[model samples]
Target: MASSVLQIVSPIKGAPKPIGPTNKKPMRPSNQLPQSLLDAARAIEKVPFHAEKHVTFQPPSRVYTMKEIGLEGCGISPIATSEPFQLFSQEAVQQCRAEIFSEPVLDKYQFSSTFTKNMIRGISAEDAPFVHALWKSPQVANAVSKVAGIELVPAFDYEIAHVNVLVNKDGEGEKAEDNVGFSWHYDSFPFVCVTMLSDCAGMTGGETALRTGDGEVRKVRGPTMGTAVILQGRYIEHAALKALGGQERTTMITPFRPKNPLIKDETVLTTCVAISDNSRLFYDYCLYRAELLQERMRLQAQWLREQKEAGAPFDTASVKKFIEEQREFLDTTLEQFI
Candidate 1:
């Protein structure tokens, strides 16, 4: 993937560029949440995550390819988006919801941003044990990787089970033009698994609108409760459409990057800085990048040693290319520190 392709485009018009940590104070949702929402949260039973019981992986009904979406030769993978597919069991969803709505999580992790009013992020393993273990489970990763057409891992610990919450007071749905939960923009991470945490029994128009390569719009059905949709979000310009007839719509978004250390990482902090605790975000980002660099260097050195032991002449061009790639990687990392 070229650096140009990964450039961050602001989702909202006139959005200010991220300086450092803009969210100095704890920002809460503007409106008071409905009592029903809180009551429902308190009703769910909490349980430790057990993959065998929680994961009910099923292949998606349909997967759109980059070519089909007129975006061939773009993105890190050939697959573009997937139709809603069964991912978690109903019990699993309830457990996740309980964790997300717990008092501790709400008090500490709630984040509000210009892009979305209410979000719950930066939940650590200690804060939400079930949620953290769910994303880290091999079963979940394997299912997502199968749909993604590439091996992937969670982007980082801080991003696991990032929640987006929306509550519509009026029974009516917003007009199409006004239904966007997230405005049009590419994701900072290479891929994302969007799982619905709220029921969508009577919901309508909660689809993902994707912009095709030639500028046409395509809508994919959103996942229902306990289901998920896999998307190459970093390469696709898309937005989340609000669902009608549902009082609450909550979704978990877990970002992913290719598991291979050598794969190009286009992760950026543009979209996260404004909504995140800057200290934690920078630490997680830097640590992961450094680890990737360490592994890459080890691999390169091993290859060089093998070549020399085999009596092969020094491949100056190959060595120089590796050095240049690492230099660019380091440069990209440095740019995110601001």
Candidate 2:
């Protein structure tokens, strides 16, 4: 499948960077991974990562509270904007559209059953200032916080986006025959900022439908340029309604998972593991397991001591203390990942 070629636009030069503690790096094409890294990938070419059969886990019984999709419910709107909207500028929108259309999807079924073409600034521990600037904007941050009702920022704020092209064929039916992009599904990310660059005027379909907390699906079309929908995708399931009139929908989907200190530490270790071969990955994985186990043990010990001093029942308090200590450990352990 041939596609338009994407040009690696040099990241914005001389942009004011973050105030303190930055691990800055130059931006490169997503697929332009170093040859050495590509070669290293050969070790895991056919390696199967099997789970330890001895470990057992009971299914979690805690129920997630269902919330609606309006500003009161999801605390986010399907059509969203921010002050000094730089990412959705006409020039940027066209660039994003061209960028995704230029690249063919190496992995076909990345988004459930949808046929999507996407690109990212980078997807590693390293940072890309160009892409990060777009993510770190104050206006964007405010919108995100409002939706979450808490302060939530990007785990990889700048380069964490997946510039996408959701292609709904000309003659395709709105009701999908299978799950490909057409089926409603929850996103792995905590929040999803879906910016629609394609014009909805004269288009028959291609509405982005999201299932709300009330179990009703609400479909909204970005009828104008720069229209965006921000949602807690991990909570709300979404699907792209088929675009008719042979129109193609272009979107920049930036998935931002919550900032968890423990996940950051685990990511650092796992990233190191992936660099070598299957054997090295397994080694690093084991190392991480040990680190996490030690942290857990420390938390348990602390909780028991605290309970003894308080002369209180060791019930929810113990569990709560364990969780708090784990977060603190996660924050202090590894170097900053974002």
Candidate 3:
């Protein structure tokens, strides 16, 4: 389909909620994964990665020459108390945390347990101004752009701030979750900037670890508040370290990519998928089409009822014809695939 005709809604945040008949009967379990999901896994495995022996973090408030971190190196920058760092103040972080507390986190079933690791997407519309102001700073923008070899991507490029929270203070009762931290994965963006509003101080684990192309692993520590860490999203394999004890690890995870005029970068998922591989495109469109079909059926049924109540001409034949056409297409396509 043409890009203009198909309005892409992200499956990341607002996912497909199919409303149809349910089969109450219990079915046998299968060990194998779906072919489409397998295809997704395969694509993930094929992603190219490049890295070095060590990683570092600098002050994000100052503009670094290309000689220091190179035009495309991955590293971190601690929030400085001077000029540029003052842009990200204590009041800003507190306000963001407030919004985090207010917004509802996605449950295990709603999002992928493997990638998200039960982390809450803590940013909300209420925190947008602070987020926009902090991210749009020249120091923050230039530092990331140089390391990423790309021009600075504005906060408005992808409106929704991508953040994941890791809180282990509730106790080990939640230990059954294999890893409370995120699993290893690479993003689709050119670069992903991370900074801690709060750190995992005194915590056993919960470090943000990244692996290089030479098989070298580097563990980064965001020990203090306002520390910024930049990663080569599409190049390195990275994961959050699991928190062993009761500690709070709060960080802002923002992705940067070239802006798109067509696809709306409203939601985190839509923003990522819009610039990502076609595999995600297929997955999202499949779910979106199903949702659209369900809505079409509902609206048609409602129209028929209204026509009958008003004593207007009820075109039962047209409705049946539409149903037959959609059903035939869906059945044939599904049968061929299954």
Candidate 4:
């Protein structure tokens, strides 16, 4: 089979360089990888992952609690455990995580990297084969499609799916309980996929916590080795359990949303695009616009809430200001992206 060719386009200079605390190397194209590695990625994309396993569906036990956790979808085990995982070892996995999370987004958002300083920055999907392998994996893509109920597309808006590593730089912090956890909020997309990368010795805590919008919470210990989870993105709330012992908690996040040119409320479609596909360049251009739009809407909503609270006239001028600012930001940002 011909190798998949992803023509990467960027907003600024040349291709995005590999970013991290220290690494300044520019990323090489996929052509640089060994042929066997490329073949493995392609092969995984053509077959069914988790074929031996049944889809595990979780129906809500209660119905009245719609205000809090308002989602409806089936939960399934992760898709790409069998083949791709066989290629990585613990040491190799950690190295991959270190390199990938060096991207700016994950490094800033992940708390463990914030407090202890194990984070890197400027990571792009273009730079990492492990990430690309998962993105191109048929097992993962198909699983996302089945759960999302639509044909998912590869995203190009951003590096949408990624991994997080919370390992100790030295052996002293290798226990599970020492990792930082995230706050409870549904992600921005319609579907979410998480795979546990490290589970054996010194890794503890870091259980997956699920919740409804109504505040019901359930905790499940993550799968060892190749175990994974896929869930509805909008309706359920989730957080990583606080790491307790001395180990670090590491996992990969793969989120899918509608293809670029998204219509509002289109998340109703389960399988969309993975958000970093090359086709999504235009779509990603729109994301900044959408974010600006959302910021304006939020300001309007807040103004209305305040007006009601204070028994005052609605703040029309404030709303107008927000719109103007949003427009300016969108215009400037779109020029850069396009």
Candidate 5:
């Protein structure tokens, strides 16, 4: 397979825009979860994460590329999606669940949005140490990067381990026809690692459907417990299909960006501002952009200095291009504040 080719496009077309600033304050779920489900989730013991024992990395059985999916040159990576692969051990998943259901995490992080009714996000190291450690683990990142075909790091601390939860009481929510869990839209991040925290043995029809560039749709199978699927979601129009028959469906979504600071980062917060704590979200976004900008400027300075020492004339065109790109990056960052 050919290595991924970077295709930079600003303000990704067809991306979902924020509904409004009304959701600036965290919106609680309209309906409370059943006590039984809460008990089951909290019953698991909390254990410190140990990469050697918790991470069970295994390559996906099959990986779909942009060319294969008819979306060649669409995103930052040549790979589009990977079949479900083992990523964490059952013990690790249990610990994550325990942390998610902990009182502090549940009270502060649970958020409701038009996209997903029951979600737990904004989890940091202080809120869920085990979950945080698992995502920050180099082993886990390397495994996800291998499948994504790019060296990647978490988009930012705010995006780590965002959990989407669905509970079907008495299997009453099962639908005979296919249903959409998350409406068709592109992700805000370049890549995402979605790991399942719920058993899917009894579930059916929980695949991710991708809209090909030619308007055709292709489905990728959903991950089972302790398994995960990686996708270059920023450029792919996709949706999560509802799973029927599962008592509970919970998945951890961790967004990622290229590890190289020079890589064009088109990450936008259009889909996040409304659903997140504006203060923290903005802080993380600005800090990340600043860090990337710092590295880029430093590299550019070094290159200019080296060229001057070699008696080469200043490359005005190249310098202008860099400044323009950085200006756009700064503009994009400013736009996210609202």
Candidate 6:
């Protein structure tokens, strides 16, 4: 439960396979909007928008600051070049982008339509060098540290590099519309920093749009290569503009937050999504209990086999206990996901 114990297991190997709605059922087009999502988006429209710009291409980069952009306390910084930025190099990031697009994107919910594969590999803040470098930079660190009021530690922080590779050529036809663009939603974190790593080519329509409380829509052209944008992640309602000109929009979305040290009922991954509500703790606790139960069952099974091989009485009660724990843990975890 402690942060030290939850250090993310080494980054998972092999890119995650695309996820989609698994049910084979077909979906009907409905014009009606979900009132919940609509309301959430509308709530974002009530905040004011402030834009900040910084033109720098070198280390110790300067961060432009702004006050309130939405009720969530969002802000933006337009910087020239994030060269030697705290994170990955231009070339290294380009390679990551290339690899992300090399494969197909899939829907995570396994619903009727597909969701593009935007991945967050397990990068332990403790061991992540690029992240460490970035956090160490006076420019990047000072900004966040000022807000957090504590000197941030790399290993204890929660950070991930998000790579979104959009299709510019429009290959999937109708299905491409599913990928048109996501609706307005806030992240689980309180704030986020976005930086463009490469030039968006062959696309015309993809824009980063934000709405102020007065219903004014401000479109921030995502970063040009090496440019950075920062905003409050939990309060601002924003979405990617539909990609235009047949080119895929590519960008890096990174979020920073303090690490939760307690062993909760949810996995670290789910925590990132549930941090805003703070309800993720319950889910994490359930998940941890479930996994522990599973391991217990596996060990019990192995013990029973060993007893039988030795011609000793197998502990049938132990195996029964395993089955009971597995069922209980699963039942609890499923409820949270639902």
TM-score of 5: 0.93
Which regions of candidate 2 are displaced past 4 Å?
A: 1-66, 69-87, 97-130, 157-159, 168-170, 173-181, 212-215, 259-320, 323-338
Model 1: residue 150 alpha-carbon error in angstroms? 0.3
Per-residue CA lDDT of model 3 for 136-168, tens digit only, reads 555556655655444546433233345555545
lDDT of 1 by residue, 1-338 (tens): 11111121222222123232345444777865577777788798778899999999999988999899987877778899999999999999988988888888988888886677788999988989999999999999999999999999999998899899988877645644587877888888889999999989888888999999899999999999999999988888898987888788999999999898867777787778777877898899999999988988887777777776777777777678778778877887888765
- In candidate 5, the residue pairs with backbone N, CA or C atoms under 3 Å apart (3 or more residues apart, or in different chains) clash, namely none
Worst 10 residues of 1 by lDDT: 1-10
Decoy 1 TM-score against native: 0.91
Better of 5 and 6 by lDDT: 5
Query: Which is the winner by TM-score between candidate 3 and candidate 5?
Result: 5
* Candidate 4 to truth, TM: 0.45
Best by lDDT: 5
Residue 129's lDDT within candidate 1 is: 97
Model 1, residue 292: C-alpha shift (Å): 0.8
Model 3 residue 252 distance off true place after TM-score fit, in angstroms: 1.2
Model 2 Cα lDDT, one tens digit per residue, 104-134: 3222212211123323323222222223444
Model 1 Cα displacement at 94 (Å)?
0.3
Candidate topping TM-score: 5
Could you tell me how far off, in angstroms, the CA of residue 94 lies in candidate 6 after the best superposition? 3.5
Q: Rank the candidates by TM-score, best first.
A: 5, 1, 2, 3, 4, 6
TM-score of each: 0.91, 0.48, 0.46, 0.45, 0.93, 0.43
Clashes of 6: 36
C-alpha lDDT of all candidate models, in order:
0.83, 0.42, 0.43, 0.42, 0.85, 0.41
As a whole number from 0 to 100, the lDDT of residue 44 in candidate 6 is 33
Question: lDDT by residue for model 4 over 13-42, one digit each (tens)?
Answer: 111111111222212222122343224323
